[model samples]
Target: MKTRILSLILLTVFASAAPAQKNEQNRPPIIDAHVHAFEKDERWTHKVANPLTGQPMTATTEQSHMQATLAEMKKYNVVKAVISNDYQAVLRWKAASPDHIIASYGFYDPSSQDLAFLRREHAAGRLMALGEIGAQYEGIAPNDPKMEPYFALAEELDIPVGIHIGLSKPGIAYDDAPKYRAALSNPLLLEEVLIRHPKIRIYVMHAGWPMLDQMVGLMWAHPQVYVDTGVIDWAVPRKEFHVYLRRLVEAGFGERIMFGSDQMVWPETIGMAVEGIESAAFLTEQQKRDILYNNAVRFFRLDKK
Candidate 1:
């Protein structure tokens, strides 16, 4: 009887000491629709704090950043990523991880020479998409005439485009981007552009956060438009992010929403971003799968590849 009691106590202790297991191993494969790559630069040496959490991310060298990002992707079963950066930096990442990387050209304002370069690169199959086109940082609206040619080019190529349309870093307008305006983040600004270029496959980056009504209206009006939950997936408070996402899903737009990390400097944010969607109780198993992988597959036409 004493021996049986001791065994029972040992069993309880062992069970209590064991680490809780997550079903992540059984989780469906993911495709992060937004990611960024960069060359070795002094800027990477500085730790940046997460605006919502006040937690400073670890500083990383270019090599470490690439290694950690890839490791995180593997850990989370991320099968593919749409990566944007300077031409050469993106090329390097693609060369290193050809199977996982979808190369995109990220630009603010493209010079005539830059446009020519993009044309040549796309023809040569070096670039697949155009954007994080961040003209908003320059206070340029999506309907600005200056953006027309870029949209035209995207339409002509039949490749996807991801545009920055929503909130930037807190206080970014005060310093980093003096021209930045919150008003330009409105999804409604894209209406004219969308109407003019009906064939362009474009997705709003950050899902046009905090502009729920405008975003919903835009998507309802323009069925071709899609969105990526980039920085907001992990950068915003979880409760707020979930509420916004739930609204989009409930509004019958779940099929167009895709997962993105917008993982600029912090590699671990990739996993955090995935967890953000996984933690949403309102989403069904199929809805979560669609957001994580299927939606992007359909949007990007990956099945054709």
Candidate 2:
């Protein structure tokens, strides 16, 4: 009779909790940790490879792309996106919808960026992040001397950084960033920097894919480091992505992984990135919720907003 009574109580508790759980699961807002916005007249456009054709994907006009991005954000329930773009361009886009965009300083050359300007923007609440600091494209590592100032600044200010790590698309060497180095993709190389700036909120942009062991080692050693599923979430071959992601999840780092569209010129890919995380067969419902929304919220402190 005691056992029967206990079971009834347990069922009653679960029944009462079910609705709240379901409501929370349905549509929690997302924080897309990595994305870039391009102006139409700007020479640079966000590029994505066609998974099917192995060819370049074209984007509509810059105006159309921005419109599509915001629309998709609404459709996907993404409340905020961390945008990496030129300083003025970031200002223009964020000014249009200040609440929705988290301004990030996108640096091509770490040595060339104006630290003073960066600090000012960050101080003004116009910039909250410091990357897509793509040194790998220049055959540079995250720990390169040129990167020290930028990393140090982020650490000093307690701003989150989303750095590029891991492989670039195949044949990227043929593109403008010919100096791309595959070896620099290793997440372990960031150790020195991590050690130097222990308190800085940092997340590897690609989650150091194809370097899973290294990334796992990095994560195991440094609890402060986090990651985002950018291109791999949408662009990589599904099986390859899943194998790496499954191992990461199983190894007890699921809480640290966040979602990023890496949506450069491709606005439509935003939904694809969301679908990639949502469609993962290995992740449970709760795990999906964490990856989709909760984890990023914690990483960026978006809940405080």
Candidate 3:
């Protein structure tokens, strides 16, 4: 009689807890994989001075932009955002929102100076990943010896590398200005580095831009390769961008695709993209979960806690 009663009690408790557990499991957490933030600075601007064009960037305040971002995240229930920025701003966001921000370092190019700093930061646990690094339209290469140290350290530490491919700012000098072209945007160029250091988690940002289809192929070929949908959605026409992303999902690359607003433009833009992904007909509920949270959680090892 005592054993029967104990068993009955446990069953009763589990039966009552089932719905709550299901509800918890059903609620998907939102994560913005591509994000940029800045500190309180007087001279910050989202507009980049086209080095190639020699045009100046119109300065804008980051205060309103950041506030709007936080509000949007709250609206969409975004649990966290993987944030990157120039050295100063990254540190500021980390300090301000340590709980919600996963900080990363940026490499302008394959410069020894930048590589040394990132390598040291990576070893010290100051940055979670290495990225927005790669050959720009200007025809720079990342595997140069200067970038080798950073790559090696990242490989050793087991952090993902994010590369800003496809689209980039023009050159400062007109003669040497980087041109946007298919040759410069090829994902195959990364094959050498990927084959050389297979352990490194490399993410092709902007879904490799106008080369999304090509990038999908690259991700298929390389188990360790991944891509983040950054400003592409907002930057491109909605109808066409939707079709492009749909093809990515149809190709079964949804899990490998990460969600990011490329928040350089604005914080609200981040919320809109998250909503777009959530409502996407191509992605099932569980698939949405993977894209928004699980993928990042696994890619970045956020659950190490």
Please, what is the TM-score per model? 0.88, 0.85, 0.76
The list of candidate 3 runs beyond 4 A from truth reads: 1-27, 39-59, 62-64, 142-146, 168-182
- Comparing candidate 1 with candidate 2, which one achieves the higher lDDT? 1
Question: Which residue ranges in model 2 land beyond 4 Å of their true spot?
Answer: 1-26, 41-59
Could you tell me which residue pairs clash in candidate 1?
none
Lowest lDDT 10-residue stretch of candidate 3: 1-10
Please give the distance, in angstroms, between residue 235's alpha carbon in candidate 3 and its true position after superposition.
1.8
Give me the displacement of residue 194 in model 1, in angstroms.
1.0
lDDT of every model, 2 decimals = 0.82, 0.77, 0.64
Per-residue accuracy of model 1 over 1-305 as CA lDDT, tens digit each: 00001111111111112124444566578999898877754344444443445444453466667776887787788888999876587788789889898999987664433688889999999889988888888888999988888899999999999999888877777766788888999999999999899999999999999899999999999999999999889888899999999999999999999999998876778888998999999999999999999999999888622
The order of the candidates by lDDT, greatest first, is 1, 2, 3
Model 1 residue runs over 4 Å out of place are 1-25, 49-56, 111-113
**Position 130, candidate 3: lDDT:** 72
Worst 10 residues of 1 by lDDT: 1-10
